[model samples]
Structures are given as C-alpha cells and as structure tokens.
Target chain A: MELTGAQILIKLLKEEGVKTIFGYPGGVVIDIYDELMKSDIRHILVRHEQGAVHAADGYARASGGVGVCLVTSGPGATNTVTGIASAYMDSIPLVVFTGQVPVHLIGNDAFQEVDIVGITRPCTKHNFLVKRTEDLAKTVKEAFHIARSGRPGPVLVDIPKNVSVTKIKYKAPGPVKMRSYNPTCNPNKRQLQKVLELIKAAERPVIFAGGGVILSKAPEELTKLAKRTQIPVTTTLMGLGAFPGTDPLWLGMIGMHGTYRANMSTAHCDLFLSVGVRFDDRVTGKTDTFASQAKIVHIDIDPTSIRKNIPVTVPVVGDCKCTLEELNRMLEGVDLGDLDKKRKPWLDQIQAWKDTKPLAYEQKDIIKPQYVVEKLYELTEGKAIITTEVGQNQMWAAQYYHFDKPNHFITSGGLGVMGFGLPAAIGAQLACPDHIVVDVAGDGSIQMNIQEMATAVQCNLPVKVVILNNGYLGMVRQWQQLFYDKRYACTCMEHAPDFVKLAEAYGASGFRATKPEEVESVLKKGLSTPGPVIMDFVVEKEECVYPMVPAGAPITEMLLV
Target chain B: MLDADKHVLSILVENQPGVLSRISGLFSGRGFNIESLCVAVTTDPTVSRVTLVTKADQMIIEQIKKQLNKLINVIKVHELTGSPFVEREMVLIKVHAKPEHRAEILRTVDIFRCKVVDVGAEHYTIEVTGTEEKLDAILSLLKPIGIKEIARTGVIALFREPK
Candidate 1:
C-alpha cells in the first residue's frame, strides 16, 4: 500500500503486534502523533521522556513482551538515556522511536537535533536512523527483531521529520535474517556432561541463578533441575523470583546484601552451577576470591557474558530455558538413587548457616523500614507485584519480601537508578491490572520521580507506594558511616516535602505513619484504597542494612548484624 | 603475570550501515586499545572485511574477539597468530628531492621497490607497501633528507595457509 511514513509506522507497529505505546509528542513528531490519533493503538502521554521509557520497561517486565515508546529529538532523546541504560543493564526488551531533525539538518546541529544514535550506541543492543520513507517498515521490523532476539535489550529507531510526512510504497518485510545474530539455544552435550559430572561428584553444589532465567521464562525448568538434583538455589537481585522463594531449598538472594546461608553456601560449595547470570561486580564482590572452592559452571545466551568476570570451570553459551531442558533430559537417563543421601550433610550445613543471623533487625519505638517491608509482605501474602527504588529501601524490600513467581519482583538491579520504582510500579500495574502492584521506595529515591504519582492518578493504576521515610539518602549515609568514618556530607535531605500532602496534591490518597504502632493501619488503609495511594512511614534514620560486603571484599567477609 | 602481546584480527561483516560504528564503539566503549585499523569491501558486494591490530593481554583479546563476534553484522572473526601470516602497510612518502639529492633518493626508493607515483619540482610522492619494519627502514633512510609529507595506511593482513 502507498502510505506516508507515519502511516507506515502505524502499520509496522500493528504488524509487530504492538497494542500500546508510552509517548509524548513534540514538534518533529507531530505528524506521527497525528497518525496515531487516528489509529486504533492506544498512546500513553507521559509527563517526560524518562517516564515513557521506564513505563515501557515496567510494562515489558510485567507482560514479558517488548514495550514500545516514542519521543522527539535532542533533549527528548537525551532524557531517555538513564531509562535506556537501566533496561540495557537489566536486559529488558524495548523498542524506542525518536524523532530526528530533517535528514539534511542531522549533522548541522539544527534546533532540537542530537546525535542520539552515536550517543546511544554504547548502551543499545542496536539502533537505526531511517532516512527514506521506504526504509521505515524494514527499519521498524529490524528494530523489533533486534530488541527482542537473543539476549534482549533496547533498540532505538530515529525518524527524520520529513520522512514521517513523506509518502512511500510500503511492503511488509519477511522474517529478519542476520548471519551473525544467531544465539545459541541448545547446550553442548560435552559441556553439559562435564556439568553433570561436577554435580555428581561434588559434596556441596549451589545453583546460582540470575535474570536470564526469568528472561528465558525457564523458572520451571530451573526449579526442575534444582529439585531433581537436590541442589540449593540462590538468586541474584534480578533473579529473585526465578526460583520459588518459599521452597526449603531456596536460599535468598546472593551478593553484597545476600542471605547468610546463600553467601556462605556459595563461598564453601564445591560446585556452582550459575544459570543465565552475568556475575556482575555487585554479585561477585571480589572476583579473585569469589567461589574460591567451587568449580563454577555458567550458562547464558550471550557468549561474552560467560567468562567476562569470574573464571568458570565449564561455560555453556545457550538460552537458559533450552539449556536447562537439555540438562534435565540428560539427567533423566542418569541414576540418582542416593543423590539426597549424598547432599544431606551439605543441606544440614546450609540450614545451620541460615539459622545464624538470618536477616535480623531490631524493632524499637521508632518505625523501622524493614518492619514496614515485612508488614507489606505479610499483607500482600507474597502475591503483590513489587517494584522498588534503589538504596536502603530496595535492600529492605529485597530482604523482607518473598517472591514466588517470575516477574513479580522488579527493580533497577544493575544501574541502581533512583526514581525507578514508582513509574515501574505504574507500568507493572498497567500490565497486570487485576493484581496488586506496590512500589517500596526510600524517602530520597521516591522524591526523585514523585511526579509519576500524578501519572498513576491519571491512569487509575492504583499503584500503592510504601515510602520508608528515613529523611536521608539512606544507602549513601550508611556507606559514610561504615567507610568514611561517619563523614556525613551532603547525604541528609532535611528539607523535604510533606509526602502525604504531595500525594493528595497529585489527586491520590496520602497517609503517614509516625510511630511503629501506626505502620499497620496506614499500610492496610493505603493498600485497600481503590486509586493510587502513597503511605509514608517515618523510619529510623540511623538504621543500616546489614551483611555488608565492602567493595572488592569477598562475600565471605561480611559485616553482619 | 600474563604479558601483553600484539595481535591482528580479520573480521568479515555485513556491508550495512552502523556495523562499523558498532565494532569501533565496542572497542572504544570498553576501553580496548586499537593500535591500527583498515577496512574495505570484500569480493562479495554485501560483505566488508575489517582488519584491526590491537595490543592486549590474552584474556582481553579473547574477550574482544568474543564481543566482536556478538555484533549482529559480524560474520566471522579470525585472529592471526605466528609467523605464517603475511602483513602489509602502505605508505605514501613525499621526500624533499632537490636537484642535488635526487640521485640518492631514487637509489633509496629503488632499494625499497617503491614506485614514485607523483613528482613535483622539489618533492616526489613515492608509494611503498610492505611490512611495518620495511616501511620504518625506508622512512628512517629518507628522514636525513627531510621527508616533506607522509601518509600511512594502517596494517592489512592475510593468513598464508598451505595451498
């Protein structure tokens, strides 16, 4: 069909099965917005470009589909950088469309012009700048393909202002075929055999899983492998819900603020089977001492992630689901009559470690942040889809809440960006409207994008925000206390807005809990509210998250409670 | 300690937009040092061959190769090793060729098997293609006479397998 580039974009988006887009219109994108106005697809008008990206990210995480967003050029494009990097670090699939200056004015630094492609190259999985209207369909298709394929990440397509209005003969392209883009799905039999041997021979085996398992939708397969072999599973922050958190074999998240048993088991285990994990610095602590006694096995879709950080005994480059299925198939043929008997002593040791100081915090007259997370967790019964802003509040939530399903616990794991939780919770609620969605936020991080409460109010998302109001940048203050000899410089936020009034101003219900006694009633009331609700609990400002493994120190050497 | 070593890598990639940027950006973004680089289209119109010379320890180079292989347009990456491979760098040297120094410069050019592609009244643009060592030797010989201008295309290499 002969259509303008804007119409072609709509057609391509429909072809890709994109039903909704988070976007904000601007000068260069007016034509596209005009076409969108007449199209069947829904458009969410966010207050800023960052919110658009984060909303898309939240939607992607919740729905397991590529989230789409559109924004104009220059500042509009630059504003999405943090959100794009957050998605990139966490491996979220998103297709972002940005308007460009007319093709001729691209390099001339025209008004509202930016080299977004060059700027985003280091962060994006791949990006495109469409010059001709005819190439729009193909570029759109390729962008979707690249964004969702293999180890999925964000992809950007920049459309020139003229191209959006120019008419072109458009044809739907065939399936994308890139010779070098094929990701490994099936695990090598030899490597799997080696892993099997290691699992069979080792006395203590720990299965360290990560976000890849969730991204691959292989939680069932991973659980199968862990249960059949009777190996305890520890998850990264991103991998929180990949394994059922309530299972007896489930050790809580591993790394800096990891559970005692999880970190100890990892340190002492003879075999570590890491599935779909990149072993980021936060997870490994110190590379040289990480899993020193273990023969590590890493399975991931990306080959570069195999040995990028810590050395591994066996590296299998393949999709997590496919690889786990292959491992289970091979295990079906093996005799494991006495596997449990062999792992009994190891299980006992891990249980002992779990008994020793397992995520402890004292409850005083003041409302504790950890207590708030625990109460929320109990209220939701581990069923709410929870997102979190970074720092102390994030850690408290991670420690207190237990997730039983994939995509239930979403956070800015890699980037640790503040202002993520509220928008993310809004996006998640948008994706899963039937379920309860909550954003556990720190006082400092919540204020970063408190404006998004208005978004929740506008969309009627009913995203409950539980702010641990510690009146300081809790994480940085904790670091200052531990590392810098209590030099609290610029970490305190003494002059902050009254959050309750602010939430009411945004047309949402607001509540506050001043003492430990008021925490429960406030939580119950805020959660039961039909629309967006913000509940701020005044927490102990001096309290710190425990089991701190200093930077570059091994996880074994932790400053515990 | 793992000592650092220089290596040449030949990569075949799709002759498409953004592939070069992807490759170069991968290097620069990751802080991998690229000593030299050369790129040209292959016999196949749709494929471009990129030759890059980089210096890194064995681990970093392995990581670089793995990362380069991950790019969507990269078809293959072959790291050249040992003395069996042939390498070349092309240099265009414009030496001061006064009437008195003309004979000596010509003799030096002849010794290097270089062709004088262009000539001015006082300068000769001589084209030389050989190993880096040979180019360095010729450049040093012309240095005494004051080389007016020089342009060098970074290394391009190929493996000399038994045929």
Candidate 2:
C-alpha cells in the first residue's frame, strides 16, 4: 500500500511499541502530528521542546524503555540539545525526531532549517538525515535499535518536510542488522574465574555499582553476588537504587559528597569490583589516589570505558547482567570457604567508620533541606519515584531518599543539568500512573523549567514538586563559602516568585511550610490533594551538603558537618 | 621515523554523508590529535576507507581504536603501524629550475625516480610516490633548488597478506 513518510513513521513507532511521545508541533512537523492524531500513540504537548526531551528522559528512566521525543527544526531542535546532552552523559536510551526543511532546501538554510544531525553528532550515539521517503522506515528502525542497544544513548533522526510529505510504497522494515554495530553480551569464562579467585582471596572487597547495572536490569544479579559474597556495596549517584539502601551491606554513595563510611571503605578496600561504572572525575576525587590500594576489576559493556579513567587488573567487557550472571554462576562452582566469616573483620571496620561519622545535620527553627527529604521518603515509604533538580537539593535527595528498588531515583547525575526535575516528574507520572512521582527541587533550579508546570496541570499528571526554598543556588553558594572566602558572586537568588502563588497561577495546588513542625503537614496535604501540586519548604539559606571532598582531595578526606 | 606514539589506522566505514565529520568529531571531542588523514571510496562503492594517522601512547591508541569502533558508521578499524604493511604518499613539488642547475636537478629527480609532471618557464612540478621517508628525502634534496610550492596526499597503507 502507498503511504506517506509520516504515516510510515507512525506505523514503525507502533511496531516498536512506542505508545507515547512527548513533543511540540510546528510548521515542519504538522504533517507528522497530523498522522500521529490518526494513530493510537498518545502525543503529549509540552510547553517547550526542552520540556519534551526532559519529560521523555524521565519516562525512559522510570519505565526502562527508550524515550522518544519530537520537535520542529531550528530553535525547537536546538532547545532539545541540553536535554539530549544530559541523556548522552548518563547513557539514557532516547530517539529524538526533529523536523527539518525540505531536502532541496537543506543547505539553503530556508525557513526553520538547521543541520540538526550535524549539531547533535558528538552528543548522539548515531543520527540520520532522511532525505528520501523510502529511507524513512529503515532509518526509524535503525534509530530505535541503536538507541536501545548496548551502552545506550540518544539518537537523532532528522526528517525533512518534503520527505515526510512524499508518498511511497510501504513495506515494514525487518529486524535491524548493522554490520558495523555489534555489542558483546556474554562474558568470558576465564575472566569470570579470575574475578571469582580474587573474591575468594581478598580480605576486603567492595562492590562499586553504577548506572550500567540499572540500564542492564541486573540489580538482582548484583544483589545476589554481593549477598552471596558478603561484600559491602557502594554505588555511584546514578547507581543509587541498584542495591537496596536498607541492606546491611549497603554503603552510601561513594565519591565527592559521599557518605563518610562509603568513602573510607573505598579508600581501604583490597578488592574493588567496579560494575557498569565509568570513573567520572566527580566520582574519583583524585585518579592517582582512587582505589590506590585495591586490585580493581572493571566490568562494563563499553570497552573504551574500561581503562579510560583508572587502570584495572581484570577487565571484563560485556553486558552488566550477563557478566554478573556468569560471575554468580562461577561462584557456585568454586570452593570458597565461608565468605561471610572471612569478611567479618572488613565489615566490622566499615561499621566502625560508619558509627564514627554518620551522615548528620541540625534543624531547630528554619526547615533543613535534609529533613524535608527524609520526611518525604518516610511519608512515601521510600517508594516514591523521586526526580531531582541539580545542586544541593539533588545531593540531599541522593543522600536521604533511600531507594530500595532500581529506577526509583532519577536525576541528571553526569551532566548535572538544573531544571530537569519538574519535567522528569511529569514524564515519570505519565509512565507509571499509579506511582507518586515527586521532583525534589531547589528554589534556584526549579525556576529554570517552571513553565513546565502548565504541561503537568494540562495533562492531569499528579506530579508533586517539593521545592527546597533556600533562596540561593545552594551548591555554588556552599562552594564559594568554603573555598572563595564568602565572596558570594551572584549565587544569591533572593528575589524569586513565591512558589505557592506560582503554582496557583498554573492551575495547580500550592502549599508552603516555614517552620520545621509544618513540614510534614504540608507534604501530606500536597501529596494527597494532588492533580499536580507544588510544596515549597522555606529552608536554611546557607546550609551546605556535608561530607564534601574538596576539589583534588582524596575521597577519604572530607569536610564533615 | 616510526615511533611508538605514532599510529596508522585504516578504518572501513559506510560511504554516506557526514561520516567523516562523525569520525573527526570523535577525535577532537576527546582531545586526540589526528596527524594526517586520507579517505576515499574502496572497491566496494558503498564502503569508504579512511586512513588516519594519530600520535598517542599505547593506552590512548587502544582507546582511539575502541572509540572509533563505537561509531555506527565505522565497519572495521585495522592498525597498520604494528604490522608488515605497504605505505604510499604522493607529493607534487614545484621547484625553481635555473639554467645553471637544470642538469643537477634532472640528476636528483632521476635518482629519486620522480617524474616531471608539469613544467613552466621557470619551474618543474615533479610527482613522486613512495614511503614517507622517501618523500622527505626528495623534498630535502629539492629544497636547495628553491621549491616554489608543494602538495601532498597523506599516507595510505595496506597490510601484506601472508603467503
């Protein structure tokens, strides 16, 4: 049957099981949106193209599916760059479709024309410019396949206006097979044996899990290996939920702004099994000193990430889940005697460090941000899908919100993009309708995407925004206070819109808590009354996130609260 | 001179728009230096071969190969620096030929097995092809005769198949 390129795209999306797409319409994408209206796929109209991409990222993280977004060319496409970069940094699977000018007018820079594929080349896993109607189906198929494949990242497909409008004989594309792209999914048996031997011989071993564990859906296997081996687990910020926070073997996030016990344990461990983690500078305070005493074993799907940052003794290149399964299976055959009994001394040492300097804060009158996050976690039973804006609020949520399951905590960990939380909460709410999705935001970061509140209200997504109103960009302020000798330097954001009125203006419920005692009541009211509500807690203006490792310092050395 | 840091990689890629940009972007984005690059369509019309030369340590060379492999357009990346290979580069050097030095220049060109591809009233444009060292040797010999202009196609390499 003859079909337009736009119809073919919609049909391919349906075949790929893409039920919803977040997008905004413009002149170039009108044909695509027109075809979308005739199909069953739900199109969410976001206020800005940036909101669409962030919401799609949130949806992908919460649902564990490839998030898809659509936007017109030029400014609309450029607006999604920040969101695309964030997803790229975190290795989030996303397929972003941008409308372009006609193929003949492409280089002419006609109306709404921009080289989106060129602009997004470095940030995308792959990209295609569909210049012909016949290439649409295969390009779409490849885009989805590449986006959700090994070491997943954002992919862009730019469809010109004429291509979208051109009609061609439609035949559904078969399974995508790229001769150039093949990801190793299975681990080598010898590598697994080597890892097993190390685990058996080492007196102190720590499992350092990262976002790859969650992306590969191997948290169960990771937990099993950790429990079976009795090794303590420390996660990167992105790996917060890969291991249960309540487990006795759990060490809080390890890095700059890491827990005292976690940092000290990393510094002291003998065998470090780093799973699905690329050693980012933030995670390793000083690369020379990081895991200096440990014989590190690195497991990741990407080969380039293995020895890019820190040298490893054993490098296992494969999917995280597959590698962990192989390692776990290898463990069952090995005659490793009584791992728990052997690791007692190491565990005791970690516990001693934990007991010595636990993560702590003080609150008397003004609302402390940490207390607010703790209360939210308590009220939601640690089950709320918490997305966070950047800065101190994000760090606080990562510290206080104990995620017991994978994909429960979403944040821009790698890019640290502010204004990610609110739109992400909207996407999460839409993806998991029954779950309570909340954006733990700060007063400074929330205003970056405050306009997205309208989309949440319009779509009837009951996303809660708990703004830690510190009246400043709290993270930078804390840094300036610590290192810059209190020369504030535009960090203070004193004059801001009253969040309650702002929420009411957007046709959503708004609540505020000024005193410590009023925090719980405000939260309870905002969460229960919700068809999208904003809860602003007037927090301490100068409170710093504790246990911060100064720049270039070793992870073991931290400025405690 | 061949050094441990200098590497030559022959990359097979899909012949499509912006593939070169993607490859070059990867290099610049990671701060990896591309000393010289040559690309053209191979025997297979759909595939293009990119011959790239980079200067990096062993670890970085491995990373550069892995990162190049990660690109969707790239089919295969083979390092020719460590293998028994044949490398060729062609240079067009236009040297000022005075009446007194004409015979001497002709003798030098004959020694280098270079052809006089183009000749003007005052200059001779010689075309030479060989290994990098051969090209450099001929250029040094001709530099004394006051070379007018020169253009070079960077190194392209192929590994010798074992008999």
Candidate 3:
C-alpha cells in the first residue's frame, strides 16, 4: 500500500515492537504527530526537547530495547544535543527522530532549518538526513540496527517536513548486515585460558565491573564467574547493578568516590579482571598507579576501550555476556583445589579495609543528603528503580542505595549530566509500571530541566522526585571549597524556587521536609500518593561527598573524611 | 610524558561529507598533532581512503587509532609508519629557463625524470612524482634557477610487498 512518510514511520515503529514514544511535536513534525494521534503507539508529550531524548534514554535503560523519540527543527533539534551526548557517552541505545525544514529549504537557511546531522555527528553513533521519501524506511531500519548493535549508542534520523507528507512504496526489510561494521562477539580461547590461569594462580584477584555488563545483560554470567572463583566484585558508578549490591563478595563502587575496600583492593590486587570498564579518568586516577601491581585483564565489546587509558596484560574484544559465559563454561571443569580457602586471607584483608574506613556521614543540626538516600533505600526495601542527577546527589545515591538486580539503578555515568533524574524516572516508571521509581536529585541540578515535572503529571507516570535541597551546586561548591579555598564563585543557589509550590502548579502533589524528624514522614507520604509527587528535603548546605581522590591523585590515596 | 614520534596512519572510511572534519576535529580535540593529511576515494564507490601523518608516543599512537576507529564512518585503520613502504608526491615548479639556460634545465629535468609540462618564453613548469626526499632533492636542484612558482600534492603512501 502507498503510504505517507508519517504513516510509514508509525508502521515501522509498530513493527519494531515500540509501544511508546517520548516527544514534543512542532510545526515541522505536526504530520507525524497527527499520525501518532490515531495510532495505538502511545506518545508521552515531554515539556522540552531535551527531556524527550533523556526520557527515551531512561526508557531504553530500563527496558532492554532501543529507545525512540521525536522532535522538531532549529532550536528543537539543537536542544537535544546534551541528551544525545550523554546517551553517547554512556553507550545507551537510542534512535532520535528530528523534523527538518522541507528538503529545498535545508541549506537556504529557511525559518527553522538547522544542520542537525552536522551538529550531532561527533556524538551520535550515526545519523542521516532523508531528503527523499523512498529512503525513509531503509534509513529508519538502519538507524535502529546501528543504535542497538555492537557497542550501543544514540543514532539520529532527520526527516524533512515535505518527506513526512510525501508518498512512499513500503516494503519491510530484514536485518541489516553492514560488511564494514561487523563487531567481534566471542572471546578468543587463548585469552580465556590466560584469564583462567591468572585467576587460579593469583593470591589476590578482584573483578572490576562496569556498565558494559549491564548493557550486555551479563549479570548471571558475571555472578557465576564471581561465585565460582570467589573473587570480590567491585563496580564502577555505571555498573552498579551488574552484580548484587548486597553480596558479601561485593566491594562497593570503585573510582574517585569508591568505597575503601574497593579502591584498596583494586590498587593492590595480584590479578585485576576488569570486564567492560573503559578505565575512565574518574575511575583510574593517576593511571601510573592504578592497579599498578596487577596483571590487568580487560574484556569489552569495543576493542578501542582496551589499553586506551591503562595498559592491559590480556585484552579480550567481545561482548561482555558472551565472554563471561564462555569463561564460566571453561572454568566448570578446572580443579583449583578449594578456591574460597585460598582466597581467605585476601577476603579478610578486604574486610579489614571495609571495617577500617566505612562510608560515614555525620547528620547534625540540618538533615544530611546521604541520610535521605539511605532512608529511601530502606523505605523502598531496596527495590525502587533509582535514577539520579549528577553531582553530590548522584554520588550519594550510588553510595547508599544497594541494587540487587540489573536495570534498577540508572544514571548518566560517563557524561555526568545534571537534570537527568526527573525525566529519567518518568521513563523508568513508564517502562515498569508496577515498580516504584524515584529521582534522587540535588536542588541545583533539578532546576536545570524542572519543566519535565509537567510531563510526569500529564502522563500520570507516578514517578516520585526526591530533591535533596542543599541550597548550592553541591559538587562544584565542594571542589571550590577544597581547591580554591571556598571562593564560592557562581555555585550558590541561595534563592531557589519553592519546589512544593512548583509541583502544585503542575497539578502534582508536593511535600517538604525541613528537619531530620520530617524525612521519613515526608518520604512515606510522597511515595504513597498514587500519582506523580515531589518530596523536597532541606539537606545540609555544606555536606561533602567523602572518599574523594583529589585531581591527579592516585585512586589508592583518597582523602577520606 | 609526551615522548612523541612521527608515524603515518592510513585509514579506510566512508566516502561522505563531514568525515574529514570529524577526523580533523578529533585530532584537534585530543591535542594530537597532524603532520600531513590526504584523502581520495578508493575502488569502492561508497568508500574513501584517508592518509594522515602524525607524531605521538606509543600510547598516543594507540589512542589515535582507537579514536579513529570509534568514528561511525571509519571502516578500518592501518599504521604503516615503520614498514617497507613506497611514497609519492608530485611537485610542479615554474623555473626561469632562458634560451641560454635551456641545456642546464633540461639536464636537471632528465636526471630527475620530470617532465616540463608547461613551457613559457622564459620559464618551464617541471612536474615530478617521486618520494618526498626525491621531490625535495629536485626542488633543491631547481631552487637556484630563480624558480617563479611551485605547487605540491601531499604525500600518499603504500606498503611495498617484499619478495
């Protein structure tokens, strides 16, 4: 049947099993939006174009499929840049559709014409501008394929206004196989043998997990390997849910703000089995001393991630799930005497470190931000899907909340994007309707895209936003206090809006907790509200995230508070 | 420690717009220096090959290749800096060649296997294609002849298969 480009887009999305889209339509995308109005595919009207993309990102993270979104031309297309870059940095799978000025007006600088493909080239995995109607289907197909395959990332497809109204002959296409883009999936047997040998022979072995394990859905395989070898597992900020956070072998997170045992174990381990981490600067401070004594084994789907930051003794380029599965299968037959007995001393040392310098914060006078996160964790029974905006709020949430499963803790790890949590919580709540979803946000970051609170109310997503009102840009303020002797440049947000009033204006219930006694009551009330709610807790203004390794300092030598 | 070394990088990429800008932008963004750059389409209509030379340490060399590989358009990257390779660069020199100085100019052109592509009343445009050193040597030999103008194509290289 001959169908308009908008009709074909709806058909394609349906064929791809996409049930919902987070978008804000404009003049150029009106046709697509009109078609959307009549389709069964629900469209969540986001308040801003950035929120649309980020909500889609959160949806994709919560659900293991390619997230989809739509936006308009000019400023609308440009507004999505931060979200696109954040998704790219974290390697999230997303396909963003943007409306463009009609084909003939693309270069004429027409009213709303912008070179979106050029703008997003550096960030997106791939992008396209469909000038003709016939190419729309294949481009859409290719965009989704590229977004989800190999190392996943965001892809954009810019459709002109005329193309949406043009007629096209549609024929469903099969899976795409780009000859130039095949990714290696299976780990090399020799490399697996080397990993096995190191694990068996090393007196102190530690497993460093990253986001790739969650992206590849390899938690079961990773758990099997960790259990079989009795190696302590520590995750990066993005890899929070790759292993059970409550496991005894779990050394907390590792990096600038990682736990004491996690950082110490990584610094002194004999063999470092790093699966899917890119050795980001934040994670491997002072590269020369990062795991200096260990024989580092790096396994990732992307070959470029290995040895790009730190040297690796054994590098395996393959899917995390595939590599871990094969490694576990191979280890099933190996006899390594009693693995737990051999690792006792190492585990004991790690336990001693954990006991020596446990993560602690003093809550006096004013309420602490960490206390809010800990209460949320306890109140939700460690089951609510937690998303966080960047800075002190994010680090505190990652530190206090223990996730027991994959896809539970979602945050912008690589990009450290503020204003991410509120919209992301909406997406997560939409993806898992039965589960409670909360955004642990800071006052400064929450205001960046505070408009998204309307989207939650409109969609009735029932996402709870827990704002730790610290009255400052907590992270940057901490840095200024530490490095610049408390100059307090522009990091203060002394006069912030009343969040409770803002929530009420958006037709959502709001609650505020000013003292320590009110934290739990406010949380309980907001969570049980059945509809979207915002809980604003007035937290300590001068609180600082602990276990900070100063810039250029080794991860081993942290300035623990 | 920035212990840098000169290395030649050959890459195969999609023959499309913005790719060159992306690669160059990456170099500038990462603070890696590019010594020379050249690009042209390969046998495949949809693909283009790029050649860029840069100076970097061993670690930075790996970084350059990995960053290049991360690009969606980049198909493959090959580092052929130390291998047995053949390189060619073409230079056109317009040197003053008076009637009395014709013999000397012709002799020099013959020795360099260069052709006098354009001949004016008092000048000759010599076109030479050879390795960078050979081109440099020819330019030196013609420099004292009151050279009027010169144009050169950036160097392109290929690995010389050993027997």
lDDT of 2 by residue, A201-254 (tens): 889899999999999999999999998889999999999999999999999999
C-alpha lDDT (0 to 100) for residue A3 of candidate 1: 93
On the 0 to 100 scale, the lDDT of residue A196 in model 2 is 86
TM-score of 1: 0.97
A best-first ranking of the candidates according to their DockQ comes to 2, 1, 3
| Better candidate number, 1 or 3, judged by DockQ | 1
Off by over 4 Å in 1: B97-102, B119-122
- Output the lDDT of residue A416, model 3: 86
**How many clashes show up in model 1?**
0
Error of 3 at B132 (Å): 1.3
Model no. 1, DockQ: 0.74
Off by over 4 Å in 2: B1-4
Question: Among the candidates, what TM-score does chain A have in each?
Answer: 0.99, 0.99, 0.99
- Model 3, stretches more than 4 Å misplaced? B1-3, B95-106, B144-149
Cα lDDT tens digits for candidate 3, A397-421? 9999998899999999998889999
Inter-residue clash pairs, candidate 1: none
